[model samples]
Target: MRIGITYTILRREELEIKERAGDFGEVFMLHEDDMVFPSNLDLDVVIIRNVGHFKALYLARLFESEGIPVVNPFTVMLEAGDKLLATLRLKDRVPVPDWRAGVSEKASEKAVEELGYPVVLKPVFGSWGRLLAKVNDRDALEAVLEHRKWLRNPLYGIHYVQKFVEKPGRDIRSYVIGGEFVTAIYRYSEHWITNTARGGKAEPCYDEEVRELSLRAWEAFGEGALAIDIFEGSEGLLVNEVNPNMEFKNAARVTGVDIAKKLVEYALEVAKA
Candidate 1:
């Protein structure tokens, strides 16, 4: 089997995944620093990782055009990379937080009003809780919208307003690999945002409800390797986000699962199929 991984700068998890891939087949690390499509791709399967959504989509399409299988295929990336798109897909299939999306500042303000204060203002495309604002009032929402407008990035301009579900100062990050729920962690933090990248602590959790919802969420995205960000709402587990390019170094250490090895094995399985 020939396995290829798309990456920008190799992170810890990427290096580990590459090493594990050696056990299965010849491994190729296609560096995205050049952002150039390979003139020739000799790989049977690709595990897309460590690249942005647009870049990942580009590579997935390129590889897929040549009949090379891509894990978390282009369809998955298209929906998971955009929060609004994911929300729309998961809203009917699984439990999800109340959310609204708008293109202009006035439209966002209306959405904030409808969802009420203390809503989370998120960029349509982002991760690690960056550029996320928990707006408790209209003034704060206005300020955030103004700042986003100043940045002038079109994605930032499109506001994603989600009704903030109250939790115990934490949320759940569940891992689902190849259609099976693998493990989950409770990200504990003092602040509202509880992402590990923002200093949230990871602790093991084994909630069956989280597992079921996670699997359903994965199926909603066509079932690849995904990390489902869920919140324990008053009603039930509400999926906050679905990550196609999920980073799992912390998750592996906390769960004691060799995530890299599992990912490599799944890639090889895809190659065989």
Candidate 2:
């Protein structure tokens, strides 16, 4: 069996997966810039680690066309990569924050009024808390929406607004591999966005509710490796977002779980099947 790990830059998780993949099969690190489609390649499975990369998705699609199994398959990437689509798919089955997708200034104003103050305005395609704004008032909402109008990417023009859930300054990051709950960590920070990239500290969370809710959220996305971000709402856990290419370096460090090893194991199992 042969395994391919797609990435742009080598991160800690990718590095660990590459180093350990030898135990499973011949591992190839395919960089996005170096990928050439419609070319011959030999691989039993390909794991897409680089999220939000067009080239990576193309490569995954190419490999998938050849009947090579790609983890977090292109179909899953298409559904999980877009915030609005993921929300729409999961809103009916899972507890996601109330959100509205609109492209006009009037729509933004309507969403704000309906969802209330301090709504989170996010780009449809984004991660790591980049370009996410909390509109506390109409003036701020207008300013943010106006600035987004000039964005070169049309995705920014479509406002993705969500009602911000008041939490205890933290959120849960749960890792689900092969449709199984693996581990979770609490991303603690003073700011509303508790992403590990935003300097949030990772702490191990032993809550069964977190595991249950995370699994239910993953069920909405079907099979593949996923990271579900959940918030501790007044009613219960509300899923903030579901990531197809979820970064697990901080979660691994805090939970003492060899996430890369688990992923490689799952890849080998898929290849054998």
Candidate 3:
């Protein structure tokens, strides 16, 4: 069997995945700088890593056109890579926080007003909790919007506003592999945004609601390997986001799950199928 991983630079998780996958078969590290589009490559299955969305989509679609399976699939990547798309897809199917999408400053203001104060203004396409603003009032919303208007990337102009949920100083990050819930962790921080990338600490959590909701969210996205971010809301557990190419080094350390090994084993299963 042959497995291909798309990456520009190898992070800790990527290196771990590479090492574990090597135990199965020949592993090809398809670096972005060395790849050429519209060319046929021999590989049984391709695992899309932390590459950018457009490039990852291009590679996945190219390999898929030639009958090679892609982890998380191109469809999942298409939706999960964009916060707006993922929210729309997960709405109604799962318990997701209320959100609105728009393109103009006026529309963003209107959305903020509708969603009420303390709303989260997020870039449509972002991760690691970067470029997220917790707008407490009109003044803050105006300031954030004005800054976005000057940015070169038009994607910055697009607004993804969500109602902020008041949690108990932490949130749950659940790992789903091959349609199964492997483990979960509580990311705690004094700040409102509790992303581990933002210096939030991780602790092991074994919650039934997290598993059920995470599984439902994974199935909503046509399940593969995903990290589901869930918020404990006043009503119930709400899914905040679903990441296709998730970062799991912190989660692995806290949860004691050999995530890379399980991920590689699943990728090999895809290759075998």
Q: Give the best candidate by lDDT.
A: 3
Please, what are the lDDT tens digits per residue for candidate 1 over residues 1-273? 889988988999999999999888899888877546554778989999856778887788888888999887888888888999989889989989999888889999999889987899999887888888899997898899889989978889778899988998889999888987888999999998999989999999888888889999988876578889999899878999989888888888898988888888878777888
Per-residue lDDT over 1-273 for candidate 2, one digit per residue giving the tens place of the 0 to 100 score:
789988878989899989879887788888877778775778899988775556556666888888888887887777777788888878987888888877887987897898899799988877899999988998898899888887767778787899988999899999998888999999999998899998999899999989888888888888788888899989888988888887899989988999999888888877877
Q: Write the per-residue lDDT of candidate 3 for residues 51-134, one digit (tens) a residue.
A: 576777677787788898988688888898889989988897898988888888888888888899889999988788888999
Q: TM-scores, in order shown?
A: 0.96, 0.96, 0.95
Weakest 10 consecutive residues, lDDT, candidate 3?
50-59
Backbone clash count for every predicted candidate, in the order shown:
0, 0, 0
For model 2, name the residue pairs that clash: none
- The candidates, ranked best first by lDDT, are 3, 1, 2
Model 1, residue 204: distance off in Å is 0.9
Off by over 4 Å in 3: none
> CA lDDT, every prediction?
0.87, 0.85, 0.88
| TM-score attained by model 3 | 0.95
lDDT of 1: 0.87
Q: Could you list the CA RMSD of all candidates, in the order they appear? A: 1.4, 1.3, 1.4
Kindly provide the TM-score of model 1 when superposed on the true structure, using C-alpha atoms.
0.96
